[model samples]
Target: MKNWIKHIVLGLNYLKSKNLIHRDVKPQNMLVANNVIFKLCDFGICGTLKDSISSTHLGSMRYLPPERLGNICSYGTRSDMWALGMSLLEVSQGYLPLSSESIMSFMSHMKNDWQPDIPTTLSQQTRDLISILLERDVNQRPRYYNDILSMSSMTTLEQNPSEDERNLIENILKSLPIPTPE
Candidate 1:
Protein backbone atom coordinates (compact mmCIF):
# COMPACT_ATOMS: atom_id res chain seq x y z
CA MET A 1 0.00 0.00 0.00
CA LYS A 2 2.80 2.39 0.82
CA ASN A 3 4.51 1.65 -2.47
CA TRP A 4 1.27 2.24 -4.33
CA ILE A 5 0.78 5.53 -2.51
CA LYS A 6 4.30 6.65 -3.30
CA HIS A 7 3.95 6.03 -7.02
CA ILE A 8 0.59 7.79 -7.09
CA VAL A 9 1.99 10.77 -5.22
CA LEU A 10 4.82 11.01 -7.72
CA GLY A 11 2.36 10.91 -10.62
CA LEU A 12 0.14 13.55 -9.04
CA ASN A 13 3.12 15.74 -8.29
CA TYR A 14 4.15 15.66 -11.94
CA LEU A 15 0.63 16.55 -13.01
CA LYS A 16 0.44 19.37 -10.49
CA SER A 17 3.71 20.79 -11.75
CA LYS A 18 2.20 20.81 -15.22
CA ASN A 19 -0.93 22.62 -13.97
CA LEU A 20 -3.04 19.59 -14.91
CA ILE A 21 -5.84 18.04 -12.94
CA HIS A 22 -6.65 14.40 -13.47
CA ARG A 23 -10.35 14.70 -12.76
CA ASP A 24 -10.86 10.96 -12.61
CA VAL A 25 -8.83 9.05 -10.04
CA LYS A 26 -10.28 5.70 -9.04
CA PRO A 27 -9.13 2.10 -8.71
CA GLN A 28 -10.33 1.28 -12.21
CA ASN A 29 -8.30 4.16 -13.57
CA MET A 30 -5.12 2.85 -11.97
CA LEU A 31 -3.06 0.35 -13.91
CA VAL A 32 -0.33 -2.02 -12.81
CA ALA A 33 2.58 -2.72 -15.10
CA ASN A 34 4.81 -5.80 -14.87
CA ASN A 35 2.84 -6.59 -11.70
CA VAL A 36 5.02 -4.04 -9.93
CA ILE A 37 4.87 -0.48 -11.18
CA PHE A 38 1.63 1.45 -10.63
CA LYS A 39 0.41 4.05 -13.07
CA LEU A 40 -2.58 6.37 -13.31
CA CYS A 41 -4.37 6.22 -16.66
CA ASP A 42 -7.57 7.25 -18.45
CA PHE A 43 -7.05 10.97 -18.60
CA GLY A 44 -10.16 11.48 -20.72
CA ILE A 45 -11.56 14.03 -18.33
CA CYS A 46 -8.32 15.74 -17.35
CA GLY A 47 -8.46 19.53 -17.19
CA THR A 48 -6.04 22.40 -16.88
CA LEU A 49 -6.03 24.47 -13.73
CA LYS A 50 -6.65 28.18 -14.16
CA ASP A 51 -5.87 30.43 -11.23
CA SER A 52 -5.63 27.33 -9.00
CA ILE A 53 -9.22 26.38 -9.73
CA SER A 54 -10.98 24.03 -12.14
CA SER A 55 -14.52 25.04 -13.01
CA THR A 56 -15.56 22.08 -15.14
CA HIS A 57 -17.36 19.30 -13.27
CA LEU A 58 -16.32 16.13 -15.07
CA GLY A 59 -15.37 12.94 -13.28
CA SER A 60 -16.81 9.74 -11.86
CA MET A 61 -19.57 10.68 -9.42
CA ARG A 62 -18.36 8.25 -6.80
CA TYR A 63 -14.80 9.61 -6.92
CA LEU A 64 -15.58 13.35 -7.08
CA PRO A 65 -14.98 15.64 -4.12
CA PRO A 66 -17.82 17.45 -2.33
CA GLU A 67 -16.67 20.87 -3.47
CA ARG A 68 -16.96 19.84 -7.12
CA LEU A 69 -20.46 18.59 -6.45
CA GLY A 70 -21.59 21.64 -4.46
CA ASN A 71 -19.81 24.26 -6.54
CA ILE A 72 -17.93 23.41 -9.68
CA CYS A 73 -15.71 26.46 -9.59
CA SER A 74 -14.57 25.91 -6.03
CA TYR A 75 -12.17 23.09 -6.69
CA GLY A 76 -8.52 22.43 -7.45
CA THR A 77 -5.84 19.90 -6.54
CA ARG A 78 -7.56 19.61 -3.16
CA SER A 79 -10.47 17.93 -4.95
CA ASP A 80 -8.10 15.37 -6.44
CA MET A 81 -6.79 14.66 -2.95
CA TRP A 82 -10.30 13.79 -1.82
CA ALA A 83 -10.70 11.30 -4.66
CA LEU A 84 -7.28 9.86 -3.92
CA GLY A 85 -8.27 9.45 -0.29
CA MET A 86 -11.40 7.56 -1.31
CA SER A 87 -9.34 5.34 -3.59
CA LEU A 88 -6.87 4.60 -0.81
CA LEU A 89 -9.68 3.87 1.61
CA GLU A 90 -11.23 1.47 -0.86
CA VAL A 91 -7.93 -0.27 -1.50
CA SER A 92 -7.16 -0.56 2.21
CA GLN A 93 -10.59 -1.85 3.31
CA GLY A 94 -11.24 -3.98 0.19
CA TYR A 95 -14.48 -2.07 -0.42
CA LEU A 96 -15.83 1.30 -1.38
CA PRO A 97 -16.11 3.61 1.62
CA LEU A 98 -19.42 5.36 0.90
CA SER A 99 -22.63 3.55 -0.06
CA SER A 100 -25.52 5.97 -0.21
CA GLU A 101 -28.60 4.44 -1.87
CA SER A 102 -29.36 7.60 -3.75
CA ILE A 103 -27.63 10.72 -5.03
CA MET A 104 -29.60 12.89 -2.65
CA SER A 105 -28.40 10.91 0.33
CA PHE A 106 -24.83 11.05 -0.95
CA MET A 107 -25.11 14.79 -1.38
CA SER A 108 -26.55 15.09 2.11
CA HIS A 109 -23.72 13.05 3.51
CA MET A 110 -21.16 15.20 1.74
CA LYS A 111 -22.80 18.37 2.98
CA ASN A 112 -22.76 16.91 6.50
CA ASP A 113 -18.99 16.39 6.27
CA TRP A 114 -19.20 12.62 6.36
CA GLN A 115 -15.83 10.87 6.50
CA PRO A 116 -14.97 7.20 6.36
CA ASP A 117 -13.95 5.51 9.55
CA ILE A 118 -10.28 4.69 9.27
CA PRO A 119 -9.76 1.01 9.85
CA THR A 120 -7.63 0.39 12.93
CA THR A 121 -5.86 -2.43 11.15
CA LEU A 122 -3.95 0.08 9.04
CA SER A 123 -0.72 1.65 10.26
CA GLN A 124 -0.78 4.96 12.14
CA GLN A 125 0.93 6.69 9.24
CA THR A 126 -1.61 5.44 6.71
CA ARG A 127 -4.50 6.46 8.94
CA ASP A 128 -3.07 9.93 9.47
CA LEU A 129 -2.55 10.38 5.73
CA ILE A 130 -6.11 9.30 4.98
CA SER A 131 -7.58 11.62 7.58
CA ILE A 132 -5.71 14.61 6.19
CA LEU A 133 -6.52 13.72 2.59
CA LEU A 134 -10.20 13.35 3.36
CA GLU A 135 -10.52 16.52 5.38
CA ARG A 136 -13.87 18.23 4.71
CA ASP A 137 -12.39 21.68 4.42
CA VAL A 138 -10.61 22.08 1.10
CA ASN A 139 -8.23 24.62 2.60
CA GLN A 140 -7.17 22.11 5.22
CA ARG A 141 -6.59 19.36 2.69
CA PRO A 142 -3.28 18.98 0.88
CA ARG A 143 -3.46 21.10 -2.25
CA TYR A 144 -0.42 19.57 -3.92
CA TYR A 145 1.06 16.10 -3.87
CA ASN A 146 4.17 17.50 -2.19
CA ASP A 147 2.05 18.53 0.77
CA ILE A 148 1.40 14.86 1.44
CA LEU A 149 4.85 13.64 0.40
CA SER A 150 6.44 16.03 2.86
CA MET A 151 4.35 14.88 5.84
CA SER A 152 6.16 13.18 8.70
CA SER A 153 3.81 10.24 8.21
CA MET A 154 5.24 9.80 4.71
CA THR A 155 8.82 10.83 5.40
CA THR A 156 9.72 7.70 7.33
CA LEU A 157 8.41 5.33 4.67
CA GLU A 158 10.75 3.23 2.57
CA GLN A 159 10.93 4.29 -1.07
CA ASN A 160 10.44 0.72 -2.29
CA PRO A 161 8.07 -2.03 -1.30
CA SER A 162 9.56 -4.46 1.21
CA GLU A 163 10.06 -8.16 0.48
CA ASP A 164 6.86 -9.14 2.32
CA GLU A 165 4.87 -6.52 0.44
CA ARG A 166 6.29 -7.70 -2.87
CA ASN A 167 5.26 -11.27 -2.05
CA LEU A 168 1.78 -10.17 -1.06
CA ILE A 169 1.43 -8.16 -4.25
CA GLU A 170 2.57 -11.11 -6.30
CA ASN A 171 0.01 -13.37 -4.68
CA ILE A 172 -2.79 -10.87 -5.23
CA LEU A 173 -1.83 -10.41 -8.85
CA LYS A 174 -1.68 -14.14 -9.42
CA SER A 175 -5.22 -14.51 -8.08
CA LEU A 176 -6.75 -11.94 -10.39
CA PRO A 177 -8.67 -13.03 -13.47
CA ILE A 178 -6.81 -12.60 -16.73
CA PRO A 179 -8.53 -10.57 -19.40
CA THR A 180 -9.76 -12.43 -22.48
CA PRO A 181 -9.45 -10.52 -25.71
CA GLU A 182 -12.88 -9.48 -26.98
Candidate 2:
Protein backbone atom coordinates (compact mmCIF):
# COMPACT_ATOMS: atom_id res chain seq x y z
CA MET A 1 0.00 0.00 0.00
CA LYS A 2 2.84 2.36 0.80
CA ASN A 3 4.43 1.71 -2.58
CA TRP A 4 1.04 2.11 -4.23
CA ILE A 5 0.68 5.57 -2.77
CA LYS A 6 4.19 6.45 -3.87
CA HIS A 7 3.54 5.34 -7.45
CA ILE A 8 0.28 7.26 -7.56
CA VAL A 9 2.07 10.36 -6.43
CA LEU A 10 4.74 9.78 -9.03
CA GLY A 11 2.03 9.49 -11.69
CA LEU A 12 0.52 12.76 -10.52
CA ASN A 13 3.92 14.43 -10.67
CA TYR A 14 4.35 13.36 -14.26
CA LEU A 15 0.93 14.64 -15.21
CA LYS A 16 1.41 17.95 -13.44
CA SER A 17 4.80 18.52 -14.97
CA LYS A 18 3.23 18.21 -18.40
CA ASN A 19 0.65 20.94 -17.55
CA LEU A 20 -2.15 18.38 -17.65
CA ILE A 21 -4.79 17.83 -14.98
CA HIS A 22 -6.75 14.62 -14.57
CA ARG A 23 -10.04 15.99 -13.36
CA ASP A 24 -11.19 12.58 -12.24
CA VAL A 25 -9.38 10.33 -9.78
CA LYS A 26 -10.79 7.56 -7.59
CA PRO A 27 -10.26 3.90 -6.78
CA GLN A 28 -11.97 2.88 -10.00
CA ASN A 29 -9.41 4.76 -12.04
CA MET A 30 -6.52 2.99 -10.36
CA LEU A 31 -5.54 -0.44 -11.63
CA VAL A 32 -3.04 -2.68 -9.85
CA ALA A 33 -1.37 -4.95 -12.36
CA ASN A 34 0.69 -8.12 -11.81
CA ASN A 35 -0.16 -7.95 -8.08
CA VAL A 36 2.49 -5.28 -7.73
CA ILE A 37 2.57 -2.23 -10.03
CA PHE A 38 -0.26 0.32 -9.93
CA LYS A 39 -1.33 2.25 -13.00
CA LEU A 40 -3.67 5.24 -13.42
CA CYS A 41 -6.28 5.16 -16.20
CA ASP A 42 -9.17 7.18 -17.60
CA PHE A 43 -8.17 10.39 -19.29
CA GLY A 44 -11.46 11.30 -20.87
CA ILE A 45 -11.72 14.46 -18.79
CA CYS A 46 -8.06 15.37 -18.83
CA GLY A 47 -7.24 18.93 -19.90
CA THR A 48 -4.47 21.43 -19.98
CA LEU A 49 -4.10 23.51 -16.85
CA LYS A 50 -4.60 26.76 -18.77
CA ASP A 51 -7.93 25.82 -20.33
CA SER A 52 -10.76 27.77 -18.76
CA ILE A 53 -13.42 25.75 -20.59
CA SER A 54 -12.15 22.64 -18.85
CA SER A 55 -13.08 24.02 -15.44
CA THR A 56 -16.64 22.79 -15.75
CA HIS A 57 -18.05 19.82 -13.86
CA LEU A 58 -16.30 17.11 -15.82
CA GLY A 59 -15.12 14.94 -12.97
CA SER A 60 -16.81 12.59 -10.54
CA MET A 61 -19.01 14.48 -8.07
CA ARG A 62 -17.83 12.49 -5.06
CA TYR A 63 -14.16 12.87 -5.85
CA LEU A 64 -14.23 16.57 -6.79
CA PRO A 65 -12.80 19.25 -4.52
CA PRO A 66 -15.04 21.62 -2.56
CA GLU A 67 -13.90 24.69 -4.46
CA ARG A 68 -15.00 23.26 -7.81
CA LEU A 69 -18.43 22.37 -6.48
CA GLY A 70 -19.39 25.70 -4.85
CA ASN A 71 -17.36 28.27 -6.75
CA ILE A 72 -17.00 29.24 -10.40
CA CYS A 73 -13.32 30.03 -10.34
CA SER A 74 -10.82 27.79 -12.12
CA TYR A 75 -8.73 25.17 -10.33
CA GLY A 76 -5.14 24.11 -10.64
CA THR A 77 -3.13 21.01 -9.93
CA ARG A 78 -4.21 21.18 -6.30
CA SER A 79 -7.69 20.11 -7.36
CA ASP A 80 -6.25 16.89 -8.68
CA MET A 81 -4.35 16.55 -5.45
CA TRP A 82 -7.66 16.65 -3.60
CA ALA A 83 -8.92 13.74 -5.66
CA LEU A 84 -5.65 11.94 -5.01
CA GLY A 85 -6.15 12.45 -1.30
CA MET A 86 -9.64 11.01 -1.48
CA SER A 87 -8.33 8.02 -3.46
CA LEU A 88 -5.48 7.52 -1.02
CA LEU A 89 -7.94 7.46 1.85
CA GLU A 90 -10.07 4.87 0.09
CA VAL A 91 -7.10 2.69 -0.83
CA SER A 92 -5.77 2.95 2.71
CA GLN A 93 -9.07 2.17 4.46
CA GLY A 94 -10.71 -0.10 1.85
CA TYR A 95 -13.81 2.17 1.68
CA LEU A 96 -14.81 5.60 0.55
CA PRO A 97 -14.90 8.33 3.18
CA LEU A 98 -18.36 9.49 2.07
CA SER A 99 -21.34 7.87 0.36
CA SER A 100 -24.71 9.17 -0.85
CA GLU A 101 -27.47 7.61 -2.89
CA SER A 102 -28.82 10.69 -4.63
CA ILE A 103 -27.46 13.95 -6.03
CA MET A 104 -29.25 15.91 -3.35
CA SER A 105 -27.93 13.57 -0.71
CA PHE A 106 -24.43 13.92 -2.04
CA MET A 107 -24.54 17.71 -2.02
CA SER A 108 -26.09 17.71 1.43
CA HIS A 109 -23.27 15.53 2.71
CA MET A 110 -20.63 18.00 1.49
CA LYS A 111 -21.20 20.69 4.07
CA ASN A 112 -18.70 23.53 4.22
CA ASP A 113 -17.15 22.35 7.46
CA TRP A 114 -17.51 18.64 6.80
CA GLN A 115 -14.65 16.27 7.48
CA PRO A 116 -14.59 12.54 6.96
CA ASP A 117 -14.57 10.39 10.08
CA ILE A 118 -11.27 8.60 9.72
CA PRO A 119 -10.90 5.22 11.30
CA THR A 120 -8.99 4.84 14.57
CA THR A 121 -6.80 2.00 13.37
CA LEU A 122 -4.67 4.11 11.02
CA SER A 123 -1.23 5.24 12.10
CA GLN A 124 -0.75 8.84 13.14
CA GLN A 125 1.36 9.63 10.09
CA THR A 126 -1.23 8.25 7.67
CA ARG A 127 -4.02 10.17 9.39
CA ASP A 128 -2.07 13.39 9.25
CA LEU A 129 -1.29 12.86 5.59
CA ILE A 130 -4.92 12.23 4.70
CA SER A 131 -6.07 15.22 6.74
CA ILE A 132 -3.66 17.46 4.93
CA LEU A 133 -4.84 16.15 1.55
CA LEU A 134 -8.56 16.38 2.40
CA GLU A 135 -8.33 19.87 3.79
CA ARG A 136 -11.44 21.86 2.93
CA ASP A 137 -9.53 25.09 2.68
CA VAL A 138 -7.71 24.79 -0.61
CA ASN A 139 -4.91 27.11 0.48
CA GLN A 140 -4.21 24.97 3.48
CA ARG A 141 -3.94 21.79 1.43
CA PRO A 142 -0.41 20.69 0.78
CA ARG A 143 0.97 22.20 -2.42
CA TYR A 144 2.94 19.03 -3.08
CA TYR A 145 1.64 15.88 -1.44
CA ASN A 146 4.45 13.76 -2.86
CA ASP A 147 6.85 15.55 -0.53
CA ILE A 148 4.69 14.64 2.46
CA LEU A 149 4.42 11.00 1.44
CA SER A 150 8.15 10.70 0.86
CA MET A 151 8.83 11.49 4.51
CA SER A 152 10.68 8.73 6.34
CA SER A 153 8.05 8.54 9.05
CA MET A 154 5.25 8.13 6.51
CA THR A 155 7.04 5.15 4.92
CA THR A 156 7.61 3.30 8.20
CA LEU A 157 4.87 0.74 7.77
CA GLU A 158 5.22 -2.57 9.58
CA GLN A 159 6.78 -5.30 7.47
CA ASN A 160 4.98 -7.93 9.52
CA PRO A 161 2.13 -6.86 11.72
CA SER A 162 0.68 -9.54 14.09
CA GLU A 163 -1.83 -11.99 12.66
CA ASP A 164 -4.71 -10.10 14.21
CA GLU A 165 -3.43 -6.80 12.90
CA ARG A 166 -2.86 -8.26 9.46
CA ASN A 167 -6.37 -9.68 9.38
CA LEU A 168 -7.88 -6.39 10.43
CA ILE A 169 -6.07 -4.50 7.69
CA GLU A 170 -6.99 -7.13 5.13
CA ASN A 171 -10.64 -6.88 6.11
CA ILE A 172 -10.63 -3.15 5.60
CA LEU A 173 -8.96 -3.43 2.22
CA LYS A 174 -11.35 -6.10 1.06
CA SER A 175 -14.30 -3.78 1.65
CA LEU A 176 -13.19 -1.39 -1.10
CA PRO A 177 -15.33 -1.14 -4.25
CA ILE A 178 -12.35 -2.17 -6.36
CA PRO A 179 -11.00 -5.65 -5.86
CA THR A 180 -7.34 -6.03 -4.98
CA PRO A 181 -5.64 -8.16 -7.59
CA GLU A 182 -4.56 -11.45 -6.04
Candidate 3:
Protein backbone atom coordinates (compact mmCIF):
# COMPACT_ATOMS: atom_id res chain seq x y z
CA MET A 1 0.00 0.00 0.00
CA LYS A 2 2.86 2.35 0.83
CA ASN A 3 4.59 1.58 -2.41
CA TRP A 4 1.42 2.19 -4.37
CA ILE A 5 0.96 5.53 -2.69
CA LYS A 6 4.58 6.42 -3.31
CA HIS A 7 4.29 5.66 -7.00
CA ILE A 8 1.04 7.55 -7.27
CA VAL A 9 2.60 10.55 -5.55
CA LEU A 10 5.53 10.39 -7.93
CA GLY A 11 3.23 10.19 -10.93
CA LEU A 12 1.14 13.09 -9.67
CA ASN A 13 4.27 15.13 -9.12
CA TYR A 14 5.37 14.44 -12.67
CA LEU A 15 2.00 15.55 -13.99
CA LYS A 16 2.07 18.69 -11.88
CA SER A 17 5.57 19.53 -13.04
CA LYS A 18 4.43 19.19 -16.64
CA ASN A 19 1.41 21.41 -15.96
CA LEU A 20 -0.91 18.45 -16.57
CA ILE A 21 -3.76 17.01 -14.53
CA HIS A 22 -5.16 13.57 -15.00
CA ARG A 23 -8.86 14.27 -14.76
CA ASP A 24 -9.43 10.61 -13.99
CA VAL A 25 -7.34 8.82 -11.42
CA LYS A 26 -8.85 5.53 -10.32
CA PRO A 27 -8.00 1.95 -9.48
CA GLN A 28 -8.82 0.77 -12.98
CA ASN A 29 -6.11 3.02 -14.37
CA MET A 30 -3.50 1.99 -11.80
CA LEU A 31 -1.39 -1.06 -12.50
CA VAL A 32 0.78 -3.05 -10.11
CA ALA A 33 3.61 -5.33 -11.17
CA ASN A 34 5.64 -7.73 -9.00
CA ASN A 35 3.58 -6.40 -6.13
CA VAL A 36 6.07 -3.52 -5.83
CA ILE A 37 5.94 -1.34 -8.90
CA PHE A 38 3.04 1.05 -9.38
CA LYS A 39 2.20 2.48 -12.74
CA LEU A 40 -0.33 5.15 -13.56
CA CYS A 41 -2.20 4.54 -16.79
CA ASP A 42 -4.98 6.04 -18.92
CA PHE A 43 -4.32 9.60 -19.94
CA GLY A 44 -7.46 9.90 -22.02
CA ILE A 45 -8.95 12.64 -19.84
CA CYS A 46 -5.67 14.35 -18.90
CA GLY A 47 -5.60 18.09 -19.57
CA THR A 48 -3.36 21.06 -19.08
CA LEU A 49 -3.02 21.99 -15.40
CA LYS A 50 -3.67 25.67 -16.10
CA ASP A 51 -6.93 24.81 -17.83
CA SER A 52 -7.98 22.11 -15.36
CA ILE A 53 -9.58 24.62 -13.05
CA SER A 54 -12.22 25.65 -15.52
CA SER A 55 -15.89 25.01 -16.14
CA THR A 56 -15.73 21.27 -16.57
CA HIS A 57 -17.21 18.28 -14.83
CA LEU A 58 -15.14 15.57 -16.43
CA GLY A 59 -13.83 12.35 -14.87
CA SER A 60 -15.26 9.00 -13.79
CA MET A 61 -18.37 9.51 -11.73
CA ARG A 62 -17.30 7.31 -8.85
CA TYR A 63 -14.06 9.23 -8.40
CA LEU A 64 -15.33 12.75 -9.11
CA PRO A 65 -14.23 15.38 -6.61
CA PRO A 66 -16.86 17.20 -4.58
CA GLU A 67 -16.14 20.54 -6.24
CA ARG A 68 -16.99 19.24 -9.70
CA LEU A 69 -20.63 18.68 -8.94
CA GLY A 70 -23.24 21.38 -9.83
CA ASN A 71 -21.05 24.35 -8.97
CA ILE A 72 -18.92 25.88 -11.68
CA CYS A 73 -15.85 25.31 -9.51
CA SER A 74 -12.52 24.49 -11.07
CA TYR A 75 -10.50 21.40 -10.10
CA GLY A 76 -6.80 20.83 -9.71
CA THR A 77 -4.39 18.25 -8.30
CA ARG A 78 -6.64 17.86 -5.30
CA SER A 79 -9.22 16.15 -7.49
CA ASP A 80 -6.77 13.38 -8.23
CA MET A 81 -5.92 13.12 -4.55
CA TRP A 82 -9.58 12.44 -3.80
CA ALA A 83 -9.59 9.63 -6.33
CA LEU A 84 -6.34 8.31 -4.92
CA GLY A 85 -7.84 8.22 -1.47
CA MET A 86 -10.79 6.28 -2.85
CA SER A 87 -8.49 3.85 -4.58
CA LEU A 88 -6.51 3.31 -1.39
CA LEU A 89 -9.68 2.63 0.53
CA GLU A 90 -10.85 0.15 -2.07
CA VAL A 91 -7.55 -1.67 -1.94
CA SER A 92 -7.51 -1.90 1.82
CA GLN A 93 -11.16 -2.91 2.24
CA GLY A 94 -11.60 -4.87 -0.97
CA TYR A 95 -14.55 -2.67 -1.96
CA LEU A 96 -15.45 0.89 -2.83
CA PRO A 97 -15.33 3.35 0.04
CA LEU A 98 -18.47 5.04 -1.21
CA SER A 99 -21.58 3.21 -2.35
CA SER A 100 -24.14 4.64 -4.76
CA GLU A 101 -26.16 3.30 -7.64
CA SER A 102 -25.54 6.40 -9.73
CA ILE A 103 -23.38 9.49 -9.97
CA MET A 104 -26.17 11.64 -8.56
CA SER A 105 -26.47 9.36 -5.57
CA PHE A 106 -22.73 9.48 -5.04
CA MET A 107 -22.64 13.25 -5.23
CA SER A 108 -25.48 13.42 -2.77
CA HIS A 109 -23.55 11.23 -0.40
CA MET A 110 -20.52 13.47 -0.65
CA LYS A 111 -22.61 16.55 -0.01
CA ASN A 112 -24.08 14.92 3.08
CA ASP A 113 -20.64 14.34 4.65
CA TRP A 114 -20.63 10.63 4.01
CA GLN A 115 -17.00 9.87 4.52
CA PRO A 116 -15.63 6.36 4.59
CA ASP A 117 -15.20 4.65 7.92
CA ILE A 118 -11.53 4.39 8.71
CA PRO A 119 -10.36 0.81 8.92
CA THR A 120 -9.21 -0.41 12.31
CA THR A 121 -6.16 -2.18 10.93
CA LEU A 122 -4.74 0.80 9.08
CA SER A 123 -1.65 2.39 10.59
CA GLN A 124 -1.86 5.90 11.98
CA GLN A 125 0.21 7.31 9.14
CA THR A 126 -1.96 5.72 6.49
CA ARG A 127 -5.06 6.94 8.26
CA ASP A 128 -3.70 10.45 8.42
CA LEU A 129 -2.86 10.38 4.73
CA ILE A 130 -6.37 9.24 3.82
CA SER A 131 -7.95 11.86 6.04
CA ILE A 132 -6.05 14.58 4.22
CA LEU A 133 -6.68 13.13 0.80
CA LEU A 134 -10.39 12.70 1.38
CA GLU A 135 -11.03 16.10 2.86
CA ARG A 136 -14.27 17.66 1.54
CA ASP A 137 -12.58 20.99 1.15
CA VAL A 138 -9.90 20.61 -1.47
CA ASN A 139 -7.96 23.44 0.07
CA GLN A 140 -7.63 21.46 3.28
CA ARG A 141 -6.03 18.58 1.43
CA PRO A 142 -2.33 18.15 0.80
CA ARG A 143 -1.14 20.66 -1.78
CA TYR A 144 1.71 18.60 -3.23
CA TYR A 145 2.59 14.97 -3.88
CA ASN A 146 5.64 15.29 -1.64
CA ASP A 147 3.31 15.80 1.27
CA ILE A 148 2.05 12.25 0.82
CA LEU A 149 5.48 10.77 0.03
CA SER A 150 7.07 12.24 3.12
CA MET A 151 5.14 10.00 5.47
CA SER A 152 7.36 7.35 7.06
CA SER A 153 4.59 4.87 7.81
CA MET A 154 3.39 4.51 4.23
CA THR A 155 3.21 0.87 3.07
CA THR A 156 5.15 -0.31 0.08
CA LEU A 157 3.67 -2.39 -2.74
CA GLU A 158 5.98 -5.20 -1.63
CA GLN A 159 4.03 -5.45 1.60
CA ASN A 160 0.72 -6.10 -0.13
CA PRO A 161 -0.61 -8.94 -2.35
CA SER A 162 1.34 -12.07 -1.52
CA GLU A 163 2.66 -14.14 -4.41
CA ASP A 164 -0.39 -16.39 -4.47
CA GLU A 165 -2.68 -13.39 -4.45
CA ARG A 166 -0.86 -11.90 -7.41
CA ASN A 167 -1.18 -15.15 -9.33
CA LEU A 168 -4.94 -15.08 -8.79
CA ILE A 169 -5.06 -11.50 -10.03
CA GLU A 170 -3.09 -12.48 -13.11
CA ASN A 171 -5.59 -15.22 -13.87
CA ILE A 172 -8.49 -12.84 -13.47
CA LEU A 173 -6.92 -10.32 -15.78
CA LYS A 174 -6.34 -13.03 -18.36
CA SER A 175 -10.01 -14.01 -18.24
CA LEU A 176 -11.26 -10.53 -18.97
CA PRO A 177 -12.22 -9.65 -22.53
CA ILE A 178 -9.86 -7.32 -24.35
CA PRO A 179 -11.22 -4.35 -26.25
CA THR A 180 -9.55 -3.96 -29.60
CA PRO A 181 -8.71 -0.50 -30.80
CA GLU A 182 -10.89 0.85 -33.55
Query: Which candidate leads in lDDT?
Result: 1
**What is the Å distance of residue 52 in model 3 from its true position?**
7.2
Cα shift from native, residue 170, model 2 (Å): 8.3
| Top model number, TM-score | 1
lDDT, each prediction = 0.80, 0.70, 0.75
lDDT string, candidate 3, 90-126, tens digits: 7767678656356677788876667778797877877
Against the true structure, candidate 1 reaches a TM-score of 0.88
Candidate 1, 3-29: lDDT as tens digits = 788888889788878988888888888
**Model 3 bad stretches (over 4 Å):** 51-55, 154-182
**lDDT over C-alpha atoms for residue 33 of model 1:** 71
Instruction: Provide the lDDT at 35 for model 3.
Output: 48
Worst 10 residues of 3 by lDDT: 153-162
- Estimate the Cα RMSD of every predicted model relative to the unseen true structure: 2.1, 4.7, 3.8
lDDT of 2 by residue, 84-151 (tens): 88887876666776563476566556646568676677767667777878888877876765676667
